[model samples]
Target: MTHYFSWLKNPDNRLKLLILAFVITLFPFVAVSFFAFPTTDDYCHTLAVKEMGYWGYQVHYWKTWSGRYIGTLISATQPLAYDSYLGYKLAPIVLILLYVHASLKFAGAITGDKLAKWQTYLLAFLLVFVLIAELPVVSGYFYWYTGYYYTVADIGTLYLLAYLFRNYSKLSSRNIVVLALGIILLVGMNEYTLVWLVVLSGALFFFGSVVTRKLQVKYLVLSAVALVFGVLSVTAPGNAARAESGLYPTPLKYNLLFSIKNSLAWQIHNFAKIAPALCVLALVLIPIACQLFKNKGDFKFLRAHPALSILVFVGCLYLSYFPSYWSIAEPPNLRGQCVITFWTLIGWTYNVFVLTFWALEKGYMKPVEPGKPVAWVVGLYFFFLFTGNFNYRSAWSDLLTGRAARFNKEMHERTALVLNTREEQVYVPKLKNVPYTILIVNDETDPAWASVEVNNGCAEWFFKKKFFYK
Candidate 1:
């Protein structure tokens, strides 16, 4: 057992290392998609997709619609309309990959060459943190299609912004252009990318810490350009109407804070649970604190590193506030915003703590190797649990309930019944299968399957010739 543990600690143990990394990367995804979670707003997005037909259409129409310009594009371009369950199902996967890519690259850039082998291990740990933080977001997607779109759009934009900043020194003209294109893609994700623009503009203050004055000016300029494009991308007449459909409600003070607290607490609790080893590591920090201050004066570069880290942490914290308001008044996308916020801070904190320990060991910071053992012990503990648990069916059951089963059965039966009805158009009140409008939009493929839902507590329907149910 001791030999096995020692082997993992060695950098040369590449196979075990690779396996652990792979498991951590893939495990949460297995649990997320298989449950087939669906929220109420998903029907709305599906219906919206059924209405729009291309990226251009979303861009054109969403200018007026305030909600999700990017999603409108995805919905428009999808060939199947509401029938493209496959595209809808894969949405989270696509966003998750983009997120992981941006986060890892950003962390690497910030830490630079000073990041040790053990600290490099923190990258994989950070991935695990992203997953655990993302659980509620994933769960939210199972019910509301629109929620999925909104959450992904917000997190994805924030990550892209961080990735750009972290790699500012290395960014070429090509990268900047690519970042510009990425911003356009974010248009299809949601209009709330606008919120990201606001948060990132505020982050300019932190840029001076890590970037030269010349480059900092350039970044602020590019951010302004992206902000203009983001706003314009959602300015179409049709989209404006739809977007205005969702407005900032008069927020109750308690509701806003409560929602934010719940979102934060969920992530923090999971962080403690899924990464119990981290708790142990936290406890051993008391003695390690003495060693951290010892390195306080020797390495001047260390001074910049902590300052940069604190900047990143504070920026993420402030950005978190806007998402809270949106979650309360509009679509309630706390899950994605919460994950992004929690992990941003955790990643920075992990780096700071690890560096403190490493510095202490080298007599640059402190005189203790006490926290070193704690870190190793905790890392190994996480590796075991993360690899061993593949089937979290119980967790899925708790989150998704029997909704998937019920939705499938009901949808199937309802479709068959709708086919046999004599009415040329049918309005199914409380019908939840692919929203009746999606079926009507694809009337050429299945002419017998037209349906629509009741609007605003009024169960009324207008057929080809007349109105019923006034």
Candidate 2:
């Protein structure tokens, strides 16, 4: 028993964690494997990719910009969305792996080589849990283009932070180019995080005031660039168009009340839904807290910058959400909520770590190392709890095996219609499992534009017929 527990903390545990993270990340993709079908925004974005190239995107900005503002970086998604369905379908899973890579680097920065091999592996596993455990089933946030864009961008934000922290100590040319592209993407990729970016960067301006060592010209330039991009994102013509088309625009007072209500409501819902995972989180984090050094002396750095830290802490708490308040009173769609869900997890987790570190610095509690038997039990308990409550086995099976069968059947029928019909028209049933836009103008002979249908271009895209308009 002693041998088993000791082995858990040794060199081989990192290999175990690597396998574990791969499985956790693969679970969602395998679960939603059937849902790669293009939907409303994905189709539109795919078609709109042709409008403006590397030279000009604003020419058709008013068109595709209505749903998502990919900004100039819209050019990058070309060949992927237009050339083949497989590339677009697999992009999210690829991006997710990149996010995990970036997050691991960020964690390494925070721990600063203090973590043991097992601890690092456990941290990676938990980070994956934090990201995927609470995600809504068949969520477009994972599979669809628009939602996936924001998902990867926020993770990209973590990469940017890691770069900043490390680069200040040692500059790199490659890092500069990456930061430049990342900042530009944030301008259009995610407006929700953009708002928070501006808020947090402003806080950093004051934070630098106290930390003389941080008052570098490069830091100032980076902050300025972030602020400028953030402003451009908010003032975007597309953003104004979305607001102008609000379903229920309430008065300022009512909107504030709504934000307050939703802020708590969603927070409670997320915590309650992931209650078992939270328990596992406590179990894992307690052990880590024990290992982290216990300092008896006060943190004079925090004392000198109390207000700055408080502002940053508070900004992390609310800034990701404050942008929603300015929008309509109605609840945002599932895809839209991904931003809040992710950032809320980040903000809440960060504050908890800050408080934990502070207590460790002040020596709040002695380390709690379980006996071998107890430690083995903790591992089993966490795995059992996580799988039982959070994995959603039925949903995964239904979507991957069940819905995939349906998609295959539908495609077969769709091809049959195209071949049999001479009028260049066919009736493809609207799907229940997925949202598919109808092809408003599929007829090639009739050049005159027809009435735009709801399920626009679905048949043409499915069959790869390339009719007059998709």
User: Whose TM-score is greatest here?
Assistant: 2
Residues 1-470, model 1: lDDT tens digits = 99977886776574456546655555445434433333233444444444453454555544555445556544444323445556544655665555556555544544443444444445544444535433443344332344555556545654665566455556677776767677666754654445455445435534652464454655555576666765665454654364335444454422766656654554454445545444443444424344445544433323434455555554444444444443443323444454444444444444455556455656684355545566677657655544453323333343256434454455555445445556754544343433211111123222112223323211111112111221
Give model 2's TM-score versus the native structure: 0.76
User: Model 2, 1-470: lDDT tens per residue?
Assistant: 78875775656775685667567645645545443544434544455555445335544553424323563354336433465656644665676677678777765554444676556655666766656656553345555554565676677777776665555445566665666567766656766666666666566555665577656555455567778777666676766666765444567524676787775565456557655555556665655645553421221222323345555755554545545664765444554566656665555444444555566556775566646565567668755655664334443544545654465355445446666767655554443332211111124322111113433443354334444422
TM-score of each: 0.61, 0.76
User: Which candidate leads the pack in lDDT?
Assistant: 2
What's model 1's TM-score? 0.61
Window of ten residues with lowest summed lDDT in model 1: 458-467
What are the lDDT figures for the candidates, one per model?
A: 0.47, 0.54
